[model samples]
Target chain A: MAGEPVATSAAPVQPGAVLLRPPTNPVDRRAVGWWTVNLLIGFAVPVVVLVVLGLLITPARFWLFTPAVVIAFAGLAAVLALPRWWFRVHRWEVTDTAVYTRTGRFWQEWRVAPLSRIQTVDTRRGPLEQRFGLATVVVTTASAKGAVTMPGLARDVAEEIAERLTVTTQAIPGDAT
Target chain B: MNGDWRRLDKRAVPVAAVTMVGVAFLAGVPSAIGLSGISVGVALAWVLPGAVVVIAAGAGAAWLDWRFTRYQVGAERVEVRSGVLIRNRRSLQRDRIRTVDVTADPLQRVFGVVTVRIGTGEHSKGGTVQLRPVARATGDELRRVLLARVSTSVPADGRLATFDLGWIRYAPLSFLAPALGAAAVGGLFNVADWFGRVEGLVGWAIDLLAGLGLIGAIAVLVAVTLLIGTIGALGFWIEMWWAYRLDREAGGTLRVRRGLFTTRSISVEEERLRGVDVVEALGTRLAGAARVDAVATGLPTTVEDNKADQRTLLPAVPRALADRVAADVLREEVSPTAAVVLSPHPIAARGRRVRWALATVLAGELPLIVLGVLLTEVLLHVAWITAALALPIALVLAVDAYRSLGHGRVGGYLVTRSGTIRRSTVALQRRGIIGWTVRQSAFQRRAGLATVWATTAAGAGAYAIRDVGAETGLAAADAAVPGLLTPFLAPLPDSRPVTDETVAESTAAGEA
Candidate 1:
């Protein structure tokens, strides 16, 4: 909060189109490590299977070897670069009135959902995320596509955010539609 | 509650049993002929006794079901209790009920009973309750009670639109006509197979084709198909909309009652209506005809296979009339779909479309070319010929799709028009939009384009403005819903002092 310029709902809202700012906070540092490990595991299984088939099947060895080599290189590149790339890209911010998030690697999306329209807030901790001491928070509005997900946060931070969202959403008045 | 519990009509037992017998009889015809081809003794012995046993079993089941099934219209809720092996209780809050639909098939009509389907605004399994084969009077009473809250002194006759036989002209112009025609041909072959005369039928068709020259045979076949298709389309239209009536009742419910053999009365509460979708498929569009569908919330599907949705307020009428009726439904002076000045997509959108169209052609051609190289000289010729013929058609379609892309704000609705073959212009309530999703692909980023989708709770969930200019997309979203996107937005960097002027609305157009 000291270094980041946290937006306050009390700020006067101007009426015209303005450049949508990035969210203030980055996810936990351990999340990058978690993603790298997961990416390695994800890319390893396919390469292993291809290599096994290549070894067993003599006629298709050439075809399977090419794919296995290609996959291994692709996986290596993604593991080395993508997790760090996404760590810089993905950010989330919550003000009294709205929750804003910036996400996606090649195709970015910045979503803003008003607190008054939020219907439910939930926090989840998967096994890997738990190992990394991280959690994901999801806020859904009545609209089908209006789900705001902020993943790779410290567990306590995710819970606190969820709690704040729930309290604020309840305090605001609307059918959430 | 016990004293108020009412059993379904007693006569429903016979109706159900008889309906089963009728279905068996109709279905048995083909099987019987096929069986008799093997052995007359086998056919006679099996179908007769099988049918009798089925009738007895159906009667027993129907009787037991009737005896156990009871419904109660309580003060706060409506409950139905049924099932033999495992008793079940289903109830819906009276206040939550959004629609009360009454339908009667030919058999049920004869028995003076109708199936009452109660629906909520949710698309969940428990969102509907069915009271099968209730007395017609009971069904009507339930509908009146469930839908009509207060009987005001002002009786809103509520009749907004009625069936026009002249609209039958548009029947043959629908995309359904050709499909129905092809289906009829398939159905004939199926029937022939059932009768073990498929070979004979094929021989007859070949003889007819052979007698005519090649061109003549093709022409004759096309003519026959068109004739059958036209007749099928007309018949289907009649069956679906013979006595169609759209009325706005005094209690603020829009009631649509239609169908010939199977009568249906579907009521929609006005409060749930978000907007309307005016559809114009290519065939109908060329003929100056269009259909209007209620873009309301809670257009729920019941357990019955009503795959054909129940949203049509006016089916393929004059464009002028359709627009007027859509306006009427939305309680607006002019329909936003027609009235709005839609901002067309940029010239780059056309380029994008052309590139996509060519890519599509290449995708198809690649497989053909590969096969042609691997197989024979004939396939090579075929591949090149197909490429030559398909290229122009694909380009034309792509150009049409480009022309169809537009979005606008008019009245209280945000209107979006898209698609070439089936161009639909949806006028959704601006307030109904709960959120906006702005998307840009890597290619789109290079082209300075973005697709912005307005997400809502009603009707298809989201409507997108495809390939809009990046700044324009953000500006539109920002303007449409004031303050929703304001806090997140930052003014353009060091350009100039801006008023209400739209500006590259990028605060964090990050490395992504």
Candidate 2:
């Protein structure tokens, strides 16, 4: 927690200074649904196989086993639904000093890397991310792999963030920081 | 240079052909037996087709080599243009070349031809620009021009004495008993067969020796095994001894020529070498000898049987001359101070030891557990017990993060010594460090420890100092020379930041 994000009061905007705005397009809800569906399929297929095997072995206990199978599938479905709410709470911030990303609700996960420490920045888009017009920017430093996904952002916004981070990080005196 | 670099021994192709045909015949014999069920004549007929295919493939390879192989070295570059169908021409710049190695097999020697291998560092995509079966004199001239152009260091004035291994010095002390025992065992086996032929004479002798005979037979077998192992080890030592040769030429390049049947020569620029390692094998240590190898970058991978990629850059030198060679040829300060350091937490050693112990225990217990389950008819219960037992071993390994690692500065160099069985000690100059990092694992965060690794571009070997105290490691890396290489300058006592005047003066001196 020694390197956690410190609260900063917003600075007054200078008249001639260029002010950058955070992207407004939210991460795609469809991508989240697709991921949830895949997770449920994985859980359900195995459970169905086990139920079929149990029924073949013990036909008289079918009533008892069917309820157990239904309960297990319902529990799995609830777990898959919770991540949608979790993703909504996650946010990413990029400033002059550092790049920060926070995810999760009950157990928060935050990673901050100073601008001077950034080694290389890479922009990657998966098939799902491409469909949603979102990209994940990964910043590799000497210390660790730090990344922030700007989901649902316009294509132009993602490109601008990647270019600006690259230029600023390269200008820093000590590459290792 | 000669453009007429012709084909190697023509006999080699035929020898290769015969070997291929032999293999084909063996393979077809099995299939011929299988086809016999269909018809006896059909099975015999299948062998003819297999023979034809094998002969064609072998002849094709030989014909391609005979048609395509040609290499020529001019003043600027060495060109290897080969391939029968699609001609490939690869030329390497002499200036960019690092080292030239010449090797001669028995066949190549007979033909007065040798293979010249030109090595360029990591960037060279192709295998060593090979000049197959070149004249020995031309090979020598090529080596001379390449070495002159590539090496910028000061060379040694005189040749160093060659190292020799004495038979008495290398022979193991346990040789006699084993040799005698082998002879005795052979005699016993022969004696049993002879007993029937000479029943009256042998039976009388056997009855006299019956009481102590079994004990003598066991002793003989043990002795024979020991002798064979010692003889094998002695043969290796003798080969290593005969191959060792060191050449110190005028300039800072140290050329080492070694190997018995297939000789290999390696050149290392003094400034480029990071360190020299002196390794003592258990057998060598008993013999009061050690093998020394210099750590350098860009050594060619020695391929045996054209299969495994077991390449190493460590060059072996005799122990008696190690210190003097390290001082003279390498031109680096040798410190007597032992820079070896252990991990901060004993956990580093425990991690390796525990894994080995767990593997041994599991291997020993697995069969017993399976047998017990089969006997009791409770396989599922046994499997659960096995899973539960694995949990503690997994936890032990996870918690056993590397610790107690230490490194220190020695004169103008930094030395890091670590590892248990395969102990590695790397020493490199401060100016050589390219970059470094201080990393903390999730578990290390809870334990308040970090590992620091430094990267240097000097040699093939990368120097690393691991699991040192977090703050100390960071400070050590920072205090060493900066990674951004400007030009080297003489230290100015005045604390003014380096100016253009100082840069110009340093460049002038470097030019001079």
Best candidate, lDDT: 1
Q: How well is candidate 2 docked (DockQ)?
A: 0.05
Q: Which stretches of model 2 miss by more than 4 angstroms?
A: A1-177, B2-60, B72-77, B123-127, B151-153, B157-161, B166-223, B269-272, B277-290, B301-324, B335-406, B437-450, B458-461, B481-512
Tens digit of per-residue lDDT, candidate 1, span A1-177: 112122512344344334566778899999998899899999999999999999999999999999999999999999999999889988889987788888884687777777877889999888999999999999887664447899999999999999998988888885665
CA lDDT, every model vs. true structure:
0.81, 0.53
List iRMS for all predictions. Answer: 9.5, 19.2
Query: What level of docking quality does candidate 2 show?
Result: incorrect
lDDT of 2 by residue, B1-512 (tens): 43455454354465446657878887776677668779989987887777888877886787577567777666777777788878888887665566677776655565565777787543236636776656777677777767776345564655554655553354454244346446554666555554334566557656755766777755554666666656654554454345556666655566766556555555655444556544444344445444445555445533431211111222233444544555554454443113323225323333544566567657756776777667764655665577578757654444432321346776666666554323344555665554443344443333233454555433433455664443344445545554221111112222332122322332233244
How do the residues A1-177 of candidate 2 rate in per-residue lDDT, one tens digit apiece? 112112211233222111112212344455465456546666667677766777787864577467657867675866567647745745566676666554443333334455666667878776656766666677665422223444544455667878999999778775342
Docking class of 1: acceptable
Report the lDDT tens digits of candidate 1 across residue range B131-156.
98799998999998887654444356
Count clashing residue pairs per candidate: 1, 15
